[model samples]
Target: MKDRLASGVSIALLAALVAGTWWAADYAKRAVKEDPPRRLTHEIDSFVEQFVMVRSDEHGMPMTRMEGDRLEHYPDDDSSEVTQFRAVSQRTERPTMTATSQHARMDQDGARVVMRGDVQLRRLAGQGRPELDIRSEEVTLLPDEDVAYTDLPATVVNGTTRIQGRGMRYDNVSRELKVNEQTRVQIVPGSTRPAAPSARQPSKG
Candidate 1:
């Protein structure tokens, strides 16, 4: 009788130990498994191809035009993205300006535009100012404010002057251009390049 009781007690202890070990292993497995990844909210809700958007002034004059091969809008942030984008500005009394980029993002109201990848800006010659061109990797534009800026390396060409700098800023309305850091300026000695002849202009006699 004594031997049987001892054996039974030993078996009970071993069973408890096994059960405890299994429970611990199961708990560890549950803990090691990560929770399911949270879904991202940056999904595009709408998109357009060959998109064109124009903004006009109160006097019914077009101030700006934006075009893209594709435009995508996200409902989560009320922002829009564009691929192969180009923007043109013809604000009153200001030099006509154009911008092109591989990609761009605009705010909900189109007040701001951020361009990336091979960004280029061009300001047409007007009001005695020579034509200006700028190239950069990225640029930020505030259409309402008539301001554009970049913090990356940039190259500016104004008439015969070529400037290389680390950063740049320009105000369309004010016609002011600034370089954040002085890099180099190459001034080609020559008159401004002449405009192309008009297509309808008669050949010289």
Candidate 2:
């Protein structure tokens, strides 16, 4: 009888141990399943100094050229930023466009660029249109569309004419410029300043 009792107790202990191990394992699995994964932090993954990037046309001609003192890329948003940024766009038979700023942020594939701090934009003379120049604290450029705009106060100069407004939009294709609220126009009587020097073809870097 004592032997049978000992055997029964051993069996019960072994079953309990097995059950406890299974419960612990199950609890651990559940805990792991309930936990969330760690996310990547926003950081710069790459950077370059004195860099230049060019986008070419189907004919292998450089259409848009960009250069800067420094370029940093953020993987979190897939954006690139440049310091002392400069860009030029020249299409076949289209007016040459140029932009410069203290800092610039470029979106995916550089389709859109946001320029800040003493932004300067220029549309050189072409197709009988006078050269257009703009000064602002910020500007957004769409290189492919040949468009630039700003909501901040801006000053635009065309030949002897000067325009000031709080918001401005310019389309190189249509050669249309529009100024929003608080628009001011000043036209100095003079022969449109001699056409701006012919734009030099941008060279690939």
Candidate 3:
């Protein structure tokens, strides 16, 4: 009987040890699976997917339209940011202009936008107007004024005409482009249609 009692006690102790080990392992697993406490954070607004922004002219006409994959607004600076953004501008006398970039920033109710990372601007062809393209690393745009500018290296292309410069300003309203520094123009005289006869210098003696 004593031997049997000893055997029973040993079995009970073994069972308890096994249960305790299982409990310890379960506790450890739960501890590792639990998520850490979230930090306190606040923002005015944020958006993911299907983000659109529009800015209108003083006359209440739609001047610029912007769309993106992600948009975030910060009340602290009254500014907004966009990821994978594209924008379009409209004017009465000229073809619609569009821009695309990897990221963008805007303030003052999107009156102005600054875009970065492989920026490309294009003028849509319409009513015998030829298409134009501008490529740059960065650009600042005033859609209300129908203007865009960049201080970085820039390239402008239209048909077989190409312009390269360090800084550039383009006015969609007036169809004018001003290059600030290190400007070069290449035109295919026979193949490419002439675009800016008004900008040519007069013949000299």
lDDT of 3 by residue, 1-205 (tens): 9999999999999999999999999999987877778544547566557688777767887778889988888866778888898988876766799999999998888888899999999988777756878899999988778788998999877657787878878888777776666467788867855653222331100
Off by over 4 Å in 1: 1-40, 190-205
TM-score of each: 0.72, 0.73, 0.68
Quick one: RMSD of model 1? 12.1
User: For residue 123, what is the lDDT in candidate 3?
Assistant: 85
Query: lDDT of all predictions, in order shown?
Result: 0.84, 0.82, 0.79
lDDT of 2 by residue, 1-205 (tens): 9999999999999999999999999998877856467565678889999999998877788889999999999877889999999999888767889999999999978989999999999988767666789999999998878889889999888777677878878887767677775467676766543322211321110
lDDT of 3: 0.79
Clashes of each: 0, 0, 0
Weakest ten-residue segment in model 1 by summed lDDT: 196-205
Point out where model 3 deviates above 4 Å: 1-45, 58-60, 192-205
Q: How close is each model in CA RMSD to the real structure? A: 12.1, 7.7, 13.4
* lDDT digits (tens) for residues 71-130 of candidate 1: 999877889999998999987688899999999999958989999999999999877777
Q: Kindly state the number of residue pairs that clash in model 3.
A: 0
